[model samples]
Target: MTASTLDAPSAGPADTTKVKRAAIASFLGSMLEYYDFYIYASASALVFGKVFFSKADPAMGTLLALATFGVAYIARPVGAVLLGHVGDRVGRKRVMLLTLVLMGMSTFLIGCLPTYAAVGVFAPALLVVLRVLQGISAAGEQSGANTLTLEHAPFGRRAFFTSWTLTGTQAGFILATVVFLAVAGLPDQTLLSWGWRVPFWCSLIVVALAYIVRRRIDEPEVFQAEQQTRQVAKLPVVELFRTHAADVSRVLLCAFIAVCSTVFSVFGLAFATSHEVGLSKTTMLLVAVSANVLALVTQPTLAVLADRIGRRPVFITGVLGCAVMIFVYFKAIMSGNVPLIFLAALVLIGFCYSAPNAVWPSFYAEMFDTRVRFSGIAIGTQIGFAAAGFAPTIAWTLIGNSRTNWLPVAAMVAVCCAISALSAATARETYRVPLTELGKRH
Candidate 1:
């Protein structure tokens, strides 16, 4: 069927099936894209230190490995500006397809690159190049998907549907972690030589699948109407800053809440397993997988609650919960009880984090006019996400030989989470706004 045909209202029962199909398309696409992106993160922490930095001291090697992971974030804001403009000007569906191809190709190439032993410093140099491409591709993926899904959803259920976009992120992280677990057991020679490449290569399969699903989607009704009205901005980024600066700042501030997710998932994992604390890698990986699975369940449900209540209260409760639970989570990890560690990780990442996770899709999109929504969310979140991307390196700098030094690291996470809460507090309650009138002057 043509894109215009797919835009027609269904003859019977509103074809809940089409809406569902749309959700699955967004969900699977996000899962595949994030799986490719996060495999690098998981591998950087667990595998790259050994494979790409074999010659350096383990601590320094791990730091360098993590820094390489952060290098991708450097490109994120740039990608957000560029792709956000295209998405806003051209259409969301087109940019979604472009991001999938870019991410898939970059990830596949990473698998085929030479290792440190064979190419010396060039191995890491090539890795950094591919990572930057991955970052740029990712900068647009979630924002585009969230915007697309939210536009397509029935009113009152917008948050519920868009929550799946974040849910797909959880699925991707789970897939990446599971693959790493399997690869971790391989013989060191095989693992360093070729086994580690398997996860990156698998990205090709997912990328192909995402392309088919995305191609099948019509431009959302909201965007199509905007297009027909000739209201699409010629320069979305410029317009976003001029008219929506306050909302953009709100997004950037809320974006800082990402620290808890990154710290728990990446930094906490490394801190628990490294010689400083010496928790088993298997145990830490299990902790991550379990928490993500719980997040997949809770995020959508909490989003449903936000729809029933209001976005701000749900979001505030979540931020406050995360603030308290993170301290407990850290103490749990420090206590060295596996079950308690698992509980803490799951509660912090899976439950508390889900509160903010579920609310932000509607909250961010609601803050902008459709003309600049893509640019606003993409740029704002990318700027905010920058903290998440570099959080590990920053955490390391704050932490030294003294265990007491952890105060600085924990302080950073607390401060970021607090900012996110404050940002959410300042945002207008958008749950009642009509789709057409969103981002209008009060």
Candidate 2:
């Protein structure tokens, strides 16, 4: 059980081709998954209430739609435990394939579901079920992809490569926003009846592309070497909790940094469009798309910086920056100035948020040995992400039914960022930890 005894054979010189392929695969897969995820988010913010909860008051319907969006997070922890087990015990590639298929199917079904006008109460209920499945699939996608890319990357550049997994997420968010913006521009009747489903159905195309890319990706050499040595854990979740409980705790809190994302992307969208603020849906979507497009460029740059400096500083800086910027971003929304909104969103999301978004793949994965990396990250992040999943709904409730109050919501996001930064500060800097030496207790 000692570190030396558990160490697998060195993987030798990293295969540059495989490293590039793995990064591409991880990026595409994450893009596919988040594409499915964010479309639902955009729909919830734009039209799901009218589509699925039309019988309720407008405010109540919107709240319900947003609530269904959060329902997926409820299933993520369960998926993390189950899918993470498969990733660790079976193989990363297999889990990737399974999660991609599951998400695609669920999102497609959501597109096909009847509206409340047609199905009465059944519409929202079915929406919730599909969202839960999407949540489960997403639970494993990023963590598994991150583990795969990191293990394939050349020594000293893991953060740079792993950053692609998140860059793909920004791409997905942009794609989702663009599609929804087009659909949102449709007349209200057509949009409510059918236009909204177009984005959900489009997931099938991305799913096919992701599957083609993912099928070609081999499991990382490190994981294969561990399997050869019979070092793969039989129950990775159990082993992870037993041996790396503190690390798990740290990842959990640090993962709460995601709250900033949900607030910015989801609640902020709702708040900006509310009658109190009256920003156009297209304008808000434009802001999101622009910021995310900028993030796609900035995230990898910051990740490269993390590889040179350390994950902790980059991550903490992002967290603290988000705490302050959440306030600024929302205040700009309240000001109803398009120029100010875009500027605040670009700086807060495109730059500051990109730091942790790019770094966490390596930062959290490096906290565990190869044997439990997937499960450790999956479980910890899913647990923390549950809060992120519900953040919009929580913010909505805190702002009261009118949705005019922005202060409490900003305060909530700031607190989440503060907790995440503090938790990350407690973690040992693992940027320089050798692959074989990671998670080895002294």
Candidate 3:
């Protein structure tokens, strides 16, 4: 564990007001950030092909769009290093502010970019640059937000509070998907022309609101205490690598479980609505929105369970459940069984995935001392998240416009989920450990 500093003034104990403020700050910030982020995912799946890649064949355009969406993941590790350094050395609060501004600017710019018809290849190139910026900004946002909230929270309430960050993500995703579903139904000419940009342009409003919420909160006492003690690492990225290599690897593998979340939410939505599947886009969108609502409710409940039992068990179970459920979920999608699809999405994404979604914030963050917790999580998880961010693209490539034959795609998702579950099983249980001794061996 990193040593505490005595040079600075002693901070007061964690209080309810501080805890609520921290959680709300993280939640609202993440909600906005993810709203911007999820809009792109929805666009990649539903709109980017028609608007940005009009030159390519229909199937190829959609694949290229999904590829652009995946390209952001490639920037995440870089962003993690840069922003993780800021969070650890400067302050989590400051890095968060910077991330918010970056994401907001990039997302808005994406809304304003020219289309393939107007600017040819330059349009997609500009889109890629903006997408990378969004990825970089997002890479640090959640980890920093979760860290701030966890450090501010009472011992037993860490999971309960940190869970809000993910709940916010679900809410953002729901909002984004619903908006896209509505806009997508416009007359083809209007929908293709300017309607799709509405969501991206609207991101400016969300970012501004998030800034107000996030800027009001102070750095958590735990980090402040570390700063006073001069235990803040000069290079958080390096320190994280040296001290918590195993934990980093474990987090990377565990993050693969997120493939379940991404593939089911984004790719499944696309697959169900594609001509092969013949389902209405609105039906798929409704299912996604409804399932996410259930997730918002279940995520906090699962997080509370982690606080009582342990993070590993909850995380492991969630991963396993997601892996097992995905096969049936895809089967339901292929069957064109509307009721089954709705129920499966709810059971899989809403309930099963929430186990890891709600708990992993604390589970991964607790794997390192405060000195490098941010980097350990940001880098490790982003590395694994690189795989997840590409999950839709991977599914696209595997399916290759073949929505009827989803067996192979389901297997790929299952494999990733299985790896995550096994990794979680191997990781140390941290719920019972004292805050100061969290990352160290007993």
Candidate 4:
């Protein structure tokens, strides 16, 4: 019920000041990074269909835009491998700084790209290139932030501390939705032309602030010790596979839980706003902003509960809850009940999905040793998240023209959440484990 009942620190108490700094850094950094990421998501849902794929029918153009959303996921695994190595072999702070700058630059450039009407096929091609860069930068952002924060946090409150990384993520989504909400109200031409680009351009300011905050933080002592003693893995990916292969495998499956998010955020938005659903773009964006706002509160609260209980029960329960809630959430949209959609969105994502989202930063990070924590979490989650990236396209394709086509999308979400839950069920309960003893094979 309290910190006193939880596992005591294996090492001496981490500097409380550093722990606070790490939490704030992780929070602000993830807020900015995912702000860059999700604004693309908002655009792909609302703006990119017209901007880059106008040659296709509106429906097909939307699909192509969603496919471009998946393009980033394709590069995410590669980024994870590359950036994970840097984070593990170099230092957490370096990867943190590098990822922020990369995301900011790529997102800003996306704002500057020419549209399909202006540049022919090269429009989407250029979009894909920058999207891939965004993906790569994203590969390292959360894992880097989670690892840095987890390592710095006192043992008893690791979940609470690491949870800020995801809390910031919820804030990012809210911020993006709010920004998009403002731009979405512009007249059609302006909305599509220069209005959407404003959000992308705004990422520069976020990047500058996050970089400044991150620059002041130091790497965790555990990591610095690895460097001073030359114990940093020469190839963290290899070390991760050799030592923690099962954990990595489990985490990849567990990370499938992200499908719930993409389904709720990106796909759900597209579906709700489509002609069939007839919801206004602003309405759907409001649903998103509302749920994410609730997530800001729920994630931290549930994360505190995770520390008091254990990660597995809370995470597994939440995943299963999502499986059920997503079905209801989609049904709410299909019914064209605004009040119902709002409730479902709040519960499905704000609470049920937020549980797993809040916990995974600490949950996944605890599955590896300090030497390979970044690589292991990065490589595993990014690969698994690729499924999430394409879930919108798959859901859209699955739920074809039938007005009742929402079932397949909901079912797809249920299945992924089920897989994620089962994976967590098998993981070691790390809440009670001393920080130094985490990831022990036997």
Candidate 5:
């Protein structure tokens, strides 16, 4: 094994108050950031086709709408490099608060955008613009939150603490899905006209709540001391590549596991509620809400387990399990058997997928030192996640003659999961590495 940091740099110990503050801030910030992001996902699946792409055939319009959803991924890598630089160079706290404000403004503006009928092609064009902004905001949110929380956390418990960043994201996904579930229940005319906008408009409220909670978190002590000593990297991305290139590449490949998540949540929702499947929007939405609620519970437990064992074992288990479980999960969805769909969703999303989701914040971040942890994770994961951000659209295109024939889509997920598992298997185990010693070459 490589030796830990000895002479490169050193920093202060954790504080109880700061640890609590960082986790709370990370949770609420993640909740708010993803709430803004997923609301767009829900809208693309349920309402955007009719509102913004009505000129096309129904099936084609849904395809076009989902295409717009993928547009955000194009901007995420750009955001990752830019915001990741700010987080690593300036301070994590600054980027944390900046992302929340940007997401709030963009999301609420999406609520106010005119329909295609009102403005011809400009409607979809403007929607894509705002969606790009959301993508940029998200690129930095979790990486900053994870870096901040991990720095503030007690020794030997970093995984447990860093895991909350993802748990907050689950809460955000649940809250966004529940709001859409209610809005999805409205009359078609009313739903297409205004119900969808309400969720986007409500993003302002989430922003305010997260601001109050997030503002209380100070910069991590290690980061502060490094800056005061003028030891911070001048360009985090360049330094990351020069010193930690292999880890960054590994994280990019490992992030392919997110394909399982987007396929299960976004494409699965669209498929179930399509005319071919004939499942109720309410039923599909409820399946999502229930599965996510279970994730909120299981993710933290899995994170604690990673702390006890090792990050690689826990992460590898989740990746391999998701590869197999995705087939079963979709098989149940295609069957139109309500009980079976619920059971499969609970297992695939709640436990199997949740394992990697829970552990990845720490698992990936531990690969780099404080100088480039945020940049390493943001650039690597966002580029990899670009595949996930577009997975729904790809899966939709992968569908065969009948939407019910979803075996091809399941096969696609298994391919991604396999690649992700292989990438993760090569990563160095870091659950036992001290925060100060991480990423240092002995």
Candidate 6:
């Protein structure tokens, strides 16, 4: 049978039940994956320096801690290649299960690690190892989840269904910020001694619950039929690059938009709460939590709009909107006005940022046939995401001794957003493309 014929669901009404199940599974799995990720982000910004790099000067230690955060991105590309192969070849369901377990275990081990005071060099070394594992797992989580959800969704609603994968990420960020917000309010000694680890440890419970939900999800019927028909590529990465290089390049550039996320969620947190900026840690964390909470509401709505309109207009709008809003958000942080900070963050992250964040799942996945969709997205996004991993460190260096001058950081975000939007503008509008027709050469 042809690929399209294999991809068609049995002749019947759409299985709304399976679609909803896939959405929930994708959401919970993504939520757990990002919760593990963002907690490390929160700790790196607020506590990792004190816990694992206390020997360095305060500024140097914070930079080192943030650098460790980037270390995972290095591993992500590697994981993307390896796990993306599994998702594309073996099964998306298998890759999803494996990634979740790896992330949960690595995060839990991070909580159990000894501090620098106890283990000296061994402490940071171990932290880097665990971070690498987290990176690898994360590389596969979103792409696999997005591919699964998109394939399972009914025609014309792909954006809305797949958006839940990222919406779960917003939930994860909010959940992480809330946990850290509580820990940030603890006595300094208490926070440093044990509070920071609590969130990482709590990951175990969520991981268990996600595991249960994901286990119940059947492999998408399209994927199963593709397997039965032997349409799966022998090497998905090779097929992906050979057939869809431009699409992969576009996804890579579009992925740079993640710099906006790291800046807002990671570097911005450190910048605002630094001694020079004089904002409270809990307050900054709350800003992140509130903005992401709003995104949880706005993203799916925006995805529905993208389905009705087109991915390009919706995504480009968000990218350009973020370009403008980054300046306002950072300026508000520098202004020390708590009310202004919340307002700008809400606009920047909650609304503007949510646009691309919501749409990219379906947008990027649409660029590849199901045979290589997982690898295409994972490889492209992971490569671009490596920069996001280190963006906080880059911002730190750019703003040296000039905490008040937020221009460099804002400029960096503006440039990244501009490139992402320009690249996205070149993409074929896939809002109306059939599932099996995506990525087919003309």
* Predictions: Cα RMSD each: 3.0, 2.5, 2.9, 2.9, 3.0, 1.7
Where does candidate 6 stray beyond 4 Å? Answer: 1-13
Candidate-wise lDDT, in order: 0.86, 0.90, 0.86, 0.91, 0.89, 0.92
**Count of backbone clashes for each model?**
0, 0, 1, 0, 0, 0
- Tens digit of per-residue lDDT, candidate 2, span 345-415: 99999998999999999999999988899999999999999999999999989998567888999899889
Tens-place lDDT digits, model 5, residues 43-141? 998889999999998878888888888888889899999999999999999999999999999999999999999999999999999989998998889
Model 2, residue 267: C-alpha shift (Å): 0.7
Which digits, one per residue and each the tens of the lDDT, describe model 4 over residues 346-377? 99988899899889999999999888999999
Best by TM-score: 6
Which is the leading candidate under lDDT? 6
What is the per-residue lDDT of model 3 for residues 73-127, given as tens digits with 9 covering 90 to 100?
9999999999899998999999989999999999999999999999899999999
Angstrom error of the Cα, residue 289, model 4: value is 0.5
> Candidate 3: what lDDT?
0.86
Model 1 vs. true fold: TM: 0.95
Q: What are the clashing pairs of model 3?
A: 5-229
Clashing residue pairs, backbone N/CA/C < 3 A, model 2: none
Query: Which ranges in model 5 have alpha carbons more than 4 Å from their true place?
Result: 1-15
Greater-lDDT candidate between 1 and 5 = 5
Question: Which residue segments of model 2 deviate by more than 4 Å?
Answer: 1-14
TM-scores of the models, in the given order? 0.95, 0.97, 0.96, 0.97, 0.96, 0.97
Candidate 3 regions with alpha-carbon error over 4 angstroms = 1-14
- Candidate 5, residue 327: lDDT: 92
Worst 10 residues of 4 by lDDT: 1-10
On lDDT, who's better, 4 or 5? 4
Give me candidate 3's TM-score against the actual structure. 0.96
- Model 2 residue 249 lDDT score: 94
**True-structure lDDT of candidate 6:** 0.92
Q: Per-residue lDDT of 168-261 in model 6, one digit per residue for the tens?
A: 9999998888888888899999999998999999999989999999999888878888899898999998998899899888999999999999
